[model samples]
Target: MTGSGTRRLGLSRVGAALARGWRAVSWYVKELVGENDYERYVTHLRRHHPETRPMSRREFERAKLDRMDTDPQARCC
Candidate 1:
């Protein structure tokens, strides 16, 4: 291949790598922010306890808050 073609190929590979890295970072950020928790919880409930109903988002958040309030170890300044 010519010099320009080699440079283009290198740039294409770099762009793909950057895109993959961005996607990974975005997923991590979503998980870190608890954005995926509700979906995961729902999936878990459906898989493990299908007979029981899953909590609504509001109920889930309220229950989580209540638990945090009751647990001293869960507090952070």
Candidate 2:
């Protein structure tokens, strides 16, 4: 109702909006760069193959690169 109160509310709303926008941007960048691949793979393994262990991040990246190199169709040119 008061001027200072209105300013505080406006600033809080702007801060929340900025936080949400930052999260969205961070998620998009991680997805675009395949940074979430290991997490996704682990989730899939837990859901589909609970008995198996998922590969380490380093191993997974190395294998992915190898696959891309050996199989032309694995990666976009």
Candidate 3:
């Protein structure tokens, strides 16, 4: 219990540190990219992570159903 509490405290400390770092980075990014171009960042990600098979609504539904069938225990009562 003591170890778990210590680990939780350590994680919180790390999160705080990361939040501070991210704030600094975000401010720098805002200055570098400007407010207007901030939305273009998503296009950059999409360029890197191009889709293979474009999913239709039906395909998505079928895939979800198949997954639920495969894992009976995952289904809620």
Best by lDDT: 2
* TM-score (C-alpha) between model 1 and the true structure: 0.70
Model 1 has an lDDT value of 0.91
Instruction: Itemize residue pairs with steric clashes in candidate 1.
Output: none
Q: Tell me the deviation in Å of residue 69 in model 3.
A: 60
CA RMSD (A), model 1: 2.2
Which model scores highest in TM-score?
Answer: 2
lDDT of 1 by residue, 1-77 (tens): 89999999999999999999999999999987777888999999999999999999999888878988899687563
Indicate the TM-score of model 2: 0.91
Question: lDDT, candidate 2, residue 44?
Answer: 98
Off by over 4 Å in 1: 1-8
lDDT of each: 0.91, 0.94, 0.69
For model 3, what is the alpha-carbon lDDT of residue 9?
94
Query: How far off is residue 45 in model 3, in Å?
Result: 36
Q: What does the lDDT read for residue 34 in candidate 1?
A: 73
Candidate 1 weakest lDDT stretch, 10 residues: 68-77
Candidate ranking under TM-score, highest first, comes to 2, 1, 3
